[model samples]
Target: MIDTHTHLYSEQFNEDLAEVVERAKSQGVEKFFLPAIDSETHEKMLQLEAAYPNEMFAMMGLHPCSVQPDTWEQELALVKSYLDKRSFCAIGEIGIDLYWDKTTLDIQVQAFEQQIDWAIERDIPIVIHTRESFPETFEVLKRKKHPKLRGILHCFSGTLEDAQTAIDLGFLLGIGGVVTFKNGKIDRFLNEIPLENIVLETDSPYLAPVPHRGKRNESAYTSLVLGKLVDIYQKDFREIEEITTQNALRVFGMK
Candidate 1:
C-alpha cells in the first residue's frame, strides 16, 4: 500500500518515527508520499526522505492555509527553486481552503493557479486539497484544463457528483482515514465509484482511522483504511491492494 499523503516529518513523530515506519512496513505499506506545507517544512521533509530513500517520496507545494498575502510570493519562489533543483513525485497538497480562513481566498486562488502552472511545466501531477472550496477549486481546474494537467484530489471528501467531476477531469481520489469514521460518509457511496479511480492514503499524523480515531495517526493504521475498502469493494484484500497501488503508480508515474 502507498500512503499517498502524510506528514511523517511532522514533529509529532520526532521520538518514534522509526517505530512508526516499521509498524507501517509490517502492514505492507511500501510507499509513503510526503506532502510539503511550505519552504519551512522542506528541509525536514528532505531529511526524512533521505532516511528512507526509495520508500518515501516528497512533493513540493504550499498548503492553501499557508498562503498568506505577505509570504506567498517568497514561499512559492522557494518551492520553485526546489522543483528546478530536484525531482518530486507530485506538485501537491496545494489548492484553495476556506475552512480555516476566508480572507485568503483570493491569494489562495492565486497560489493555486500559479502552482498549477508549475505542475504543467514540469509535466508532473499536482495533488489537490479542496477544503470547503470544491466549487472554486473545480472552477480553477476547469479553466486551467490541459493535457498535462492531472493529479489526485487528496483527502477527497466530496459528494458523488464531486467525485464524478474529479474523474471527468482525469483526477484520482485520495482516500484516507476519513473513510473509516462513523460520519466519514464517503463509504456509503464509494462502492459506486469504481476501485480503479481510487488510491489509498493515510494522511497521517492527522486523520487516523477507526480503532485509532481521535489519536495521533500513523502509517500503520492504513490497514484499517484498507480493511474498510475491502468491505466497500467486496473484493479480496490482495486484489484491492493491487488495484489502489496501481492507481497511485499511474498518478505519480511511478513503476
Candidate 2:
C-alpha cells in the first residue's frame, strides 16, 4: 500500500525513523509521499526523501497554516525556487485552513491560487488541505478549473455533496484515519463514492485511526485505514490496495 500523505520528517519520528519505516514496510506500505510544510522544513523533508530514495517521494508547497502575512511571499518564492530546481510528486498539502485563524483567509487564498498556478503550469498534481474552508477551496478550484488542473483533496473531511463536487472537479477524496472514527461520518457514505475517486492516507502524527486514535500515527497504520475500506466497500483487501494504489499513482503521475 502507498501512504499517499504523511510527515515522516516530523520530529516525533526523529528518535527512530528507520524503525517506523520498517514497521510500515512490514505492513506492506512500500511507498510514501511526503508533503512540504514550509521553507523551514523543506530541507528536512528532502533529507528524509534522500535517505529512502523512491520509498519516500517529496512534494513542495507552503502549508496554509504556515502562511504568515509578513513572510508568505518570501516562502512562496522559496517554493518556486525548489520547483524550478527539481521535481516533486505534487505541489501540496496546500489550501485554506480556517480552523486555526480566519484572519489569514485572504493571504491563504492568494498562496493557494499561486501554488495551484505553479502546479497547472508544470503539469503536476496538487494535494489540497482544506479545513473549515471546503466551499472556499472549491471556489478556488472552480476559478482555476482546467483540463491540466488535477489533484487530491488531501485529508478530505466534508459531506457527500462535497465528495461528489471534488470528483466533479477532477479531484479525488483523500481517505484517511478520519474515516475510522466513530463520528468521522464519512464512513457512512464512503462506499457510495466510487473507489476509483478515492485514495488512502494516514496524515500521520495527526489523525491516527481507531485502536490507536489518540496515539501518534505511523505509516503502518495505513493498513488499518485500508481494513476499514475493506469493510465499507465489502471487497477483498488485495483488490482495495490495488485500486487505491493505482489511484495514488494516477494522481502523483507515478504511472
Candidate 3:
C-alpha cells in the first residue's frame, strides 16, 4: 500500500521514526509520499527521503496555513526553486484552509491558484489540502480548469456534491483513517463514488485509524483504512489493495 500524504518528518515521530517505518513496512506499506509544510521542514523532509530513497517520495509546496503575509511570496518562490532543481512526485499539500484563520483567506486563495498554475505548467499532479474551504476551492479550480490539472483532495471530509465536483474536475478523493471514525460522513459519500476514483492515504503521523485514534498515526495504519474500504465497497482485501495501489501509482507516476 501507499501512504499518499504523510509527515513522517514531523517532530512527532522523532522518538521512534525507524520503528514507525519498519512497522509500516511489515504491514505492506512500501511507499510513502511526504508533503512539504514550509522552508523550515524542507531540509528535514529531504533528509528523510534521502535516508529511505526507495520508500519515501517528497513533494514541494507552501501549505495555506503556513503562509503568512510576509512569508507567502518567499515560500512560494522557494517552492518554485525546488521544483526547478529537482523532481517531486507532486505539487502538494497546497490549498485553501479557512478553518484555522479566516484573516488569511485572500492570501490563501492567491497561493492556491499560483500553485495550481505551477502544477499545470509542469504537467504534474497535486496533493490538495482543503479544510472548510471546499466552496472556495471548487470556485478556483472551476475558473482555471485545465486537462493537466489532476490530483487528490487530501483527507476529504466534504459532501457528496463536493465529491462529485472534485471528480468532475479530474480529481480523486483521498480517503484515510477518517473513514473509520464512527462519525465520519465520508463513508456515506464513498458508496456513491466508484472505488476507481479513490486512493488510499494515512496522512500520518496524524489521523490514526479506529483503535489507534488520538494516538500518533503512521503508515502501518493504512491496513485499517484498507479494511474500512473493504467494508464500504464489499470487496475482498486483496482487490481493494491492488486497485488503490494502482490508483496511487497512476496519480504519482510511480511504477
Candidate 4:
C-alpha cells in the first residue's frame, strides 16, 4: 500500500522516525508521499526523503494555512525556485483553508491558482488540501480545468456531489482515517463513488483512524483506513489494496 499523504518529516516522528517507517512497512505500506507545508519544514522533509529515497517522495507547495498576507509571496517564490531546481512528485498540499482564518481567502485563492498553473505547466500532479472551502475550491478548479490537470483531493470531507464534481474535474478523492469516524459522513456515500476515483492516505500526525482516533497518526494506520474501505465497499482487502494503490500511482503518473 502507498500512504499517499503523511508527514513523517514532522517533529512528531523526530524521536523514532526509522521505527515509524518500519512499522508502516511491516503493515505493507511500501511507499509514502510527503507534502510540503512551507519553507519552515522543507529541509526536514527533504532530509526524510533523503533517508528513504526510494520509499518516500516529497512534494513542493505553499499550504493555505501558511499563506500569511506578508510572507505568502516569498514562500511561493521559494516553491517556484525549488521546482525550477529539481523535480518533485506533485505541487501540494495546496488549496484554500477557511477553517482557520477566512480573511486570507483572496491570497489563498491567488496562491492556489498560481500553484495549479505551476502543476499544469510542469505536467505533474497536485495534492489538494481543502478545508471549509469546497465551493471556493471547485470554483478555481473549474476555471483552471485542463486535460493536464490531475491530482488527489487529500483527506476528502465533502458531500457526494462534491465527490462527483472532483472526479469530473480530473481529481481523485483521497480516503483517510476520517472514514472510520462515527460522524465522518463520507462513509455513508463513499461506496457510491467508484474505487477507481478513490485513493488511500493517512494525513498522518492528524487524522488517525478509529482505535487510534484522538492520538498521533502514523503511516501504519493506513491499513486501518483500508480496513474501513473493505467494510464500506464490501470487497476483499487485497482487492481494495490493489485498486487503491493503482489509483494512487495513476494520480502520480507512476503506473
Among the numbered candidates, top lDDT falls to 4
Error of 1 at 177 (Å): 1.1
Q: After superposition, how far is residue 128 of candidate 3 from its true place, in Å?
A: 0.5
Angstrom error at residue 131, model 4 = 0.5
Residue-by-residue lDDT tens digits, candidate 4, 145-214: 8999999999999999999999999999999999999999999999999999998999999999999999
Superposed by TM-score, candidate 4 places the C-alpha of residue 3 at a distance from the truth, in angstroms, of 0.3
Candidate 1 — which residues are off by over 4 angstroms? none
By summed lDDT, the worst window of 10 consecutive residues in model 2 runs over 148-157
**What lDDT tens digits, residue by residue, belong to model 1 across residues 30-81?**
9999999987789999999999998999999999989998899999999999
Ranking by lDDT: 4, 2, 1, 3
Clashing pairs in 1: none
Model 3 per-residue lDDT tens digits across residues 94-179: 99998999999999999999999999999999899999999999999999899999999999988999999999999999999999
Per-prediction TM-score:
0.99, 0.99, 0.98, 0.99
lDDT of 1: 0.93
Sort all candidates by TM-score, best to worst.
4, 2, 1, 3
Give candidate 3 regions above 4 Å deviation.
Answer: none
User: Would you give me the overall lDDT of model 4?
Assistant: 0.96
What tens-digit string does per-residue lDDT give for candidate 2 at 1-255?
Answer: 999999999999999999999999999998999998998789999999999997999999999999999999999999999999998889998999999999999999999999999999999999999999998999999999999999999888899999999999999889999999999999989999999999999999899999999999999999999999999999999999999999999889888
Better of 2 and 3 by lDDT: 2
Listed per candidate, the RMSD to the true structure in angstroms reads: 0.7, 0.6, 0.9, 0.5
